[model samples]
Target: MQYKLPVSVLVVIYTLDFEVLLLERADHPGSWQSVTGSQDEGESLRETAVREVFEETGLDANHYGLVDWQVQNIYEIYAKWQHRYAPGTRHNTEHVFGLELPCVLPVQLSPREHLSYKWLPWQEAAGLVFSPSNREAILQLPAREKARG
Candidate 1:
């Protein structure tokens, strides 16, 4: 079995007005979050962000403004998911990114990865995520955007 890397990326997909895109997990019903996935060997963090966004939402990150927030969050891996990592891997470091779309377009979700998708206000999206790191990233969306401007 192939173990996943301890590094990953969390991508916040949003519009100019702060409507963030979130996905309901197929594995954990009712658990919603932004695009996220483990980084593949030899892939850059930015590449991981773009690939995860496409895999989760079917949105091509290349066409949008994909920004690396340059922020990293280290957290304990969920007990249920720790098996996917190598033995003794108890933590993960997630790099944050933002993909700004012009509007809220319909997305084609990978059925195996997500059950559904929603576009909500940043505040609402932040509240819906299960992971604290993901929530914090969504909560900072407005401030990040303002800083980008």
Candidate 2:
């Protein structure tokens, strides 16, 4: 089986007021998260972020402030998800990004990957995400935004 690229992007889509946009995974109903996807071959991290945001939410990253946190996370691949990767692949490197808008924006969910979407406050959004790293990323948003000031 072909292995997935080790690099991926995690975009925290939020508004100035901290309302974050989350999509429920079609494969896992209760698993909600910001826009995320693996990087395509020949795509830069920035390109991956922009493409994922558009593909997953129908929002143009160019219309908002897309910030690269310059943070990378290496984590063990969940046993259930390991099949997506090559044999012996046990970890992935995730790069964090943020897309900040002035308010909650309309989104068009990719029907194949996401079943629904919601805009929730940062704290609540953090609690709803299934992945610990995803939750941690949401929790860091406020601090990350402040640091950008």
Candidate 3:
């Protein structure tokens, strides 16, 4: 089996009105997060974001307003999930991106990965996410897109 790379992307998908999308993990029921996945060899960060968003939520990030947040977070891999990475891999560097939509929309979740999806107010979404970085990113969404208006 191929071990995952240490680099990954965390995409905060939100609507113009700040309804953020969160998905419940199939592996960890009730634990929710935004779109995320590791970078494949030969893929740029934007490419990773687009691929992951589509794979996780059936959304073509390219068709919407996708933007790099120009920020990243480095955090230790959870003990429960560290096995997916190479032995001795302890942390991951997550590049941040934002995908904007007109409003909350239906999502097609991958049953093997995610169990359910929901669009919540940014603040509520932030509180509901299991990852600190994902939560913080959600909390910052409104400010990050303030000028987009």
Candidate 4:
């Protein structure tokens, strides 16, 4: 089996009105997170975000306004999921990005990766994610949106 990389991307999919799309992990049961995935060997971080969003949800990331937030979260990998990475890989560096859609769109979840999906107001979605980095990224959305406006 190909062990996963220690680098990943977190793509927060949302609309201009502040609704965020979250996905529940199939492997972790109740763990909900934004569209995320590990980086492939030769891909750029933005590529990872685009690919992950498409893989986890059905959205074509580039078709919308996909912005790299210029933020990185360096955190310890959760014990339960550490085996997916190389041995001794205790930490992961996650790059954050945001995909601003026109509005809520239909989502197609990959059954193996996600159990289900939901679109919630940014605040509620921030409260629902399992990862601290994921939650923090979601929580920052409102301020970022305000700054962009």
Q: Which regions in candidate 3 have their CA more than 4 angstroms from the true location?
A: 147-149
Question: Per-residue lDDT of 1-149 in model 2, one digit per residue for the tens?
Answer: 56688789999999999999999999998889889888888999999999999999999998889989888999998898889888888889999998999998889999999999999999999999988888999999889878878
Query: lDDT of candidate 3 vs native?
Result: 0.93
In model 1, residue pairs whose N, Cα or C atoms come closer than 3 Å (at least 3 residues apart or on different chains), thus clashing, are none
Ranking 2 against 3 by TM-score, winner: 3
Model 3, span 89-119: residue lDDT tens:
9999999999999988899999999999988
lDDT of 2 at 42: 93
Extract clashing residue pairs from model 3: none
TM-score of each: 0.97, 0.96, 0.96, 0.97
Sliding window of 10 residues with minimal summed lDDT for model 1: 140-149
Candidate with more favorable, higher lDDT: 2 or 4: 4
Residue 32 in candidate 3 has what lDDT? 93
- In angstroms, give how far residue 146 of model 4 lies from its true place: 1.5
Q: Model 1 Cα displacement at 92 (Å)?
A: 0.4
Residue range 1-149, candidate 1, lDDT tens digits: 99999999999999999999999999999999999999999999989988898888888999999989889999999999999999999999999998999999999999999999999999999998998988998899888777767
What RMSD does each model have against the real structure? 0.8, 1.0, 1.0, 0.8
